[model samples]
Target chain A: TIVQTLERHFSLQDVLVGKSVLITAGPTQEAIDPVRYISNHSTGKMGFALARVFALAGADVTLVCGPTYLITPEPTIRRVNVRSAQEMYEATAAAFPKAHITILNAAVADYTPAHPATEKIKKKEAEFAIELTKTVDIAATLGTLKRPDQLMMGFALETNNEHEHALGKLHRKNLDWIVLNSLRDAGAGFGHDTNKITVMDRQETVAEFGLKTKDEVAADLLSIIVQKL
Target chain B: TIVQTLERHFSLQDVLVGKSVLITAGPTQEAIDPVRYISNHSTGKMGFALARVFALAGADVTLVCGPTYLITPEPTIRRVNVRSAQEMYEATAAAFPKAHITILNAAVADYTPAHPATEKIKKKEAEFAIELTKTVDIAATLGTLKRPDQLMMGFALETNNEHEHALGKLHRKNLDWIVLNSLRDAGAGFGHDTNKITVMDRQETVAEFGLKTKDEVAADLLSIIVQKL
Candidate 1:
């Protein structure tokens, strides 16, 4: 019975058996100086979890990561470490051609200092400002460059007009699917262990799941992706 | 000059002074027995972040929480801890009378065991299933019970049809605003440290923010809410 249950839920394992999956995790740092930089609070847990799931499902996984303290899941997964958004984009793009599925999960800095100072600016009597420019849009670039058969997904975290905004991104980025989250939802965002999610695809089908651990959500999501393929 | 520059970009002090806010955080555990129960992957970081932001803004904050490892943020901020979704509903209803703004951030479990096991069931070779029943919809319930002057927010995490579904939830729940997220987007969900978000209101206004620390996003969101007020 146990075997039957497992088989029933994961009957499509053959679909991912030889596929190469790539994932990006953590947040990029945009340096202002040697000691000061702009960054976000991503811990890379979700991306790590996805890597584990893909590997378990028999896909060759390449996890491109920013600086994170979380341990890589296992020796079977190939890991590439990077820091700034520029580096992350280069690493991801380099691996994209070989991947059957690519998940861009890094909380990359959207902007970087136009010119990074060599030393940390001293706090003098006067204030200072740093000019900034938009970082490369890795997901959009991938979307535009994707082959006909490659599966692409994007994520959106919204505080207001959540759906309208996510839909806009879905069309703008040419995503096969998109995930949406809200800051208004407690226990849902960063620095937590569990998540509740709704899955959206090009078909406009919506599937909602109750709160589950990131690992569980990753497995469930991968299952859907497998079916779609 | 520095102060002027700070004010020009964003003024943290001016955004939250006169608001009355209520927030819920952490995971609610539904007891099956005296020592065991059912729960989810909510660590309460997002809700706690909001509590800190609202408190810093000088708003009276009443935090309704579940079990978590986080330190309570403010000494004056009232906190009510509960073990189940039902208890959360009651606590939130009690705090509702005094609040002008409410953020439902808890990832409340959608279902509870129909009959909690009296003791940890010993492992058996045979398969087993536990019955489940729906938990109360805290946000929807609050929306139905809210005062006209109060602003209510909801969250939707979708894998597909990301935006239309969130918009549907906003109207269905009678929310003043809704936040949306998708897991397909990296760096956005549970157990991470950074977040990127979009905000949607009943007025159909949408605001998008780049990847940011939860604290920074909280500040930005509170600023927007204050403007609406």
Candidate 2:
């Protein structure tokens, strides 16, 4: 069991073993052309780390991801590849029903080009505009569909008013818990290996953490999930 | 001389050798949190490929880039790393004055959160509205600042009215050339290694090429630059 390797005396041997875990990672690509897209810089590091952690804890992990250079973290993990947000939604939706612990980590595009060009667009103006439309809300959908006994965790990476927004999302989405990633700290944000986080639960309790490698953050999150279970 | 490696009889040895070139690659990140960001999926392949192509042609290249998994293609390339659009603008602006050939290829976000929250914002509602404002127009600024003898090229990745929009930008930005990446072309766009490009000059002459590796596209683009020189 993964507990044998942990420094702490507390073990999640019974809680985690045989659990079904669903993790979303990477960034969704929104097409503007056959050759161009709007996307985020989610490298699948944190989410993939979580998937690995869960798998190590004897859980069955299903990782749904966007385009990336990184591969699935372990042999026991099942991976689903996707590009745009719509595709991610479909994949996640299918997997959510069976998941015991679901974590939403992918930086899904909030909006996409309303009408992708069918031909190569040539520029004639100094400034131009591309019509955009809101993408499907994947997290909200899963939050609503989750069973009472299931655990659903979400992440809110925000700047100002971070706490209030995250708290609101926790209730609005009916999530059991939410992790807040504050960009105010140095060496944090897209592509960096280190992250600082503050985890909040239903009773408004918070567990704040310092800067740590993505791998460490994964362990920290999984430990918290273990306690919750 | 890269001419020896070319399959075509035409050569650019005389025009490219020792020339100064500036190119921007990758995607600029807009922070929403200390750990989350709004960005695109620009792998820096095209810009880095341009830097490599120019260096192989004996040009002194300054490559400005955003966060990515890629490394500078060559040792001789002077690389400037940045995250946001403002940082990219400053780096490009600083390098543009000395470059004989300037290419703007970075997929910079046009708008960022007007005032990012200082703390991690939690969700309180189903739909969240993040106020945004436009970012600096790096190409237009450089276009106006460029010397008459200098050649500048821009890109227009659009969904509709491609030619008209690109043409307007050329004249409005006073650019010497512009490259259009059409989404209508299959095998082109954000994640693919192949690109199909349409080149338009100040005189409105157009050159179109089919899908090819980013490396080949770099060479083709350089050939056009050589002819213009």
lDDT string, candidate 2, A1-229, tens digits: 3344343534646557778999999988777655446666567888888888788778999999987888788999999999999999999999988899999988887776788775544334444555667778888888778788899999887777778888988988888889998767887656778889999998999889999877778888888888777
Q: Which ten residues in a row have the lowest lDDT in candidate 1 chain A?
A: A119-128
Largest TM-score belongs to which candidate? Answer: 2
Give the runs in model 1 whose Cα sits over 4 Å from its true position: A1-8, A12-15, B1-229
Q: How does each model score on lDDT? A: 0.73, 0.80
Global Cα lDDT for candidate 1: 0.73
Q: Per-residue CA lDDT of candidate 2, range B48-166, in tens?
A: 87888888778899999987778888898999999999999999999888899998888877766677664444433444555556788888888778897799988777767778888
Each candidate's DockQ score against the native complex?
0.01, 0.21
- Per-residue error for B124 in candidate 2, Å, reads 5.7
Q: Which ten residues in a row have the lowest lDDT in candidate 1 chain B?
A: B120-129
B167 Cα displacement, candidate 1 (Å): 60
Instruction: Please give the distance, in angstroms, between residue B107's alpha carbon in candidate 1 and its true position after superposition.
Output: 34
